[model samples]
Target: MPLGRLLLITVSLVASTGLASAQHDRADWDRQRARMVEAAIIEAGVTNQRVVSAMRATRRHEFVPLAQRRLAYQDMALPIGASQTISPPFVVAYMTEQLDPQPTDKVLEIGTGSGYQAAVLSPLVADVYTIEIVPSLGKRAAKTLSRLDYDNVHARVGDGYQGWPEAAPFDKIIVTCSPENPPPKLVEQLAEGGRMVIPLGERFQQNLCLMRKVNGELEREPLRATLFVPMTGAAEERREVLPDPERPAIVNGSFDEIADDEMEEPLPAGWHYLRQAEIDAKARPDDPAIAFKNDEPGLPSQALQGFPIDGRRVKRLRVGFAAKGEGIRFGQQASQWPYVVVSYYDERRVWLGDEVIGPLRGSFDWIERSEELPVPASAREAGLRIGLLGAVGKLWLDDVRIAPAGG
Candidate 1:
């Protein structure tokens, strides 16, 4: 045989071998997905046949970071940059099962994170509207989901606290972040027979709570203990902050003591930094108010950290604050609010339980709200949480007062 002929034959053989190897690699990925569903999901008791099938079909590795692809099928959260993470596979399955999605259902997911949860729901439901607070994450995940041909999923970068009102009456809603309590707006958006699965509690300590809407009310049940990043934006801004219980009556409650230099991030002299939610008075980002960009999701940029009442003197307290909005737009005759919440904290500052005062309704006129806060027995200290509780708008605050109920 000629030398040239022999060389050509060797090259042809190598090409064929490479093609076969590529085919095998693709097959292996399918097997890995199958194994993940059976071992990480099905065996763990996620028995919605449709959910199990969706889990089996989704390319888990594709949704993960390049370096972490090998461990994608393993049951654990993976870092996807921007200080965000993808939830573990088992937890995802469990959460999905709890939602009990149907073929005709329209689901809303609060934390878009990696879009894995949305991807999982895409096939099981008719449509999925997912909101991610982190803009970069939302954009990236949307791109990935689109590229992977997830046409049924819709993605947006905004605060999930207000829920998607325009797309109100969702058949089901799922929140990945833990809020102090369920956001009132989300509950209002749930359909007559809808279900919402969310994690409720403090930053480090939280529970995966499930709530079902029946006859215009919520039937809540905490399913399990889970660790999730606290909900950011408005929900985060509204979280309870335990100040030194003995701190005097009201210092800088009038928003007058606000640091002039950092008006955009105005901190009234005595208030503590609980979360970095941007509060603005007017359109100026530098002005001060308990504000939120209605169109955006994630943690608020600034919030007024409240003063804690000494649980020692009395478990309950009286709280009041003045509030108004500048650019807040309410939903179709539906009321939104800026309110105060007083919650108890143990000696270590762990959350015991809380009671909401008034979600002072949104209005142009500065309204003064005063209410009694009933503290639970677990109270060593109680924090006065003040901020807006609505979809999108600018809320202004002045003259916040906290006192022992007896006084």
Candidate 2:
């Protein structure tokens, strides 16, 4: 054989060997994930099958910085810069189990930290919308989640206190940071019949609160004592409202109650589909009517509407949600993107403000947003409308809620 031909053959063989070695290393990593699940997650008081399965499938080592990659599968949280640490495997599993996510559920996560929790949650639900306050951490985690093929996981950089409004209703909301109290905005964004798991209390004295919304009320159960990064931004200034473990705050702020047979449907009771005509009237004349609300429609989004906030004396009001606008092909830039809108009204059924709160930006991603409206001193009863408009895409809301600030 010619020398040149022999050399080419040798090079081809070397390339194939290198590829095989890389594949082998990947397999080893997969094995490590499984072992971690069994020892760190499954044995750590989390027995949920879906959570266990998701933990096994996700590659934790891929989420950490290169220097700390080998420690990813260990039971502890690791720093991902910006002073944030990914939740430990057991903690992630425990919080995930606390939510009791369903296959069709949409989940919202506050504190994207390393995006590791979102990755762990991706396989367990239809969507995982995460928000990280630190821009650098958000950018890095977003990159890592994408590289790892966690397409269902979406991330954004913003203050998580407001929650994600356009995604205003979530089946579950999990807060990784420790807040002095459950952020009222987060409570307002909790969907009826949904669950929110958060670390509540001051700094190191935080306790894990498993909050479930049922019959328009929040049932608070302290699962364990834990330490976490204190929630920053608006949360730092939050006046602590010590909640009664026996009589927690209620958000009965939106939707109807779910009966045993209606578990498959997204809308709970007290909620109805908003008509396109009503939505079109709100749109600018030059622009097209806001997208239709139905899963059958391409880029399908289902919109739910409820009565405005009941007449009540409240000092502060909050509205928001965890949302994703998928396939949102917008000609406008991010600043002009349509997001979740919280329209305010008065008790006499008269519309009070023309301003809407949220707008969706980009295509196919989840973003967290929130806005607080000051309760006018003269207003006796206020009304609110929570829904998505003026965006073209499949939008999702989980853990939707509406409530007075704090308790």
- Predictions in order: lDDT: 0.71, 0.64
| Model 1 stretches astray by more than 4 angstroms | 1-19, 241-407
Show model 2 residue runs off by greater than 4 Å: 1-3, 239-407
Model 1, position 202: C-alpha lDDT score: 57
Task: Give per-residue CA lDDT, model 2, range 1-407, as digits (tens).
Answer: 99999999999999999999999989889888887787566644578887888888778888888867888887755667765677778888888888898888888999998888898888888998999999999999999999888899889999999889998789999999988878778888889999999987754345577899888678887665455667878887773653222121223222233311322222233332222212232222333222333222222123433222332456556666555455644322334334444444443323355335655544555455667656544343222334333334444444455456664
Indicate which candidate wins on TM-score: 2
What total of clashing residue pairs does each candidate reach? 21, 39
lDDT of 1 by residue, 297-334 (tens): 22222233433445566655777876766555443334
The C-alpha local distance difference test score for the whole of candidate 2 amounts to 0.64
**Given candidate 1, what's the lDDT at residue 251?**
55
Q: Distance from true position, residue 310, model 2, in Å?
A: 50
- Which prediction has the highest lDDT against the true structure? 1
Q: Cα deviation in Å at residue 125, candidate 1?
A: 0.9
RMSD of each: 21.2, 22.6
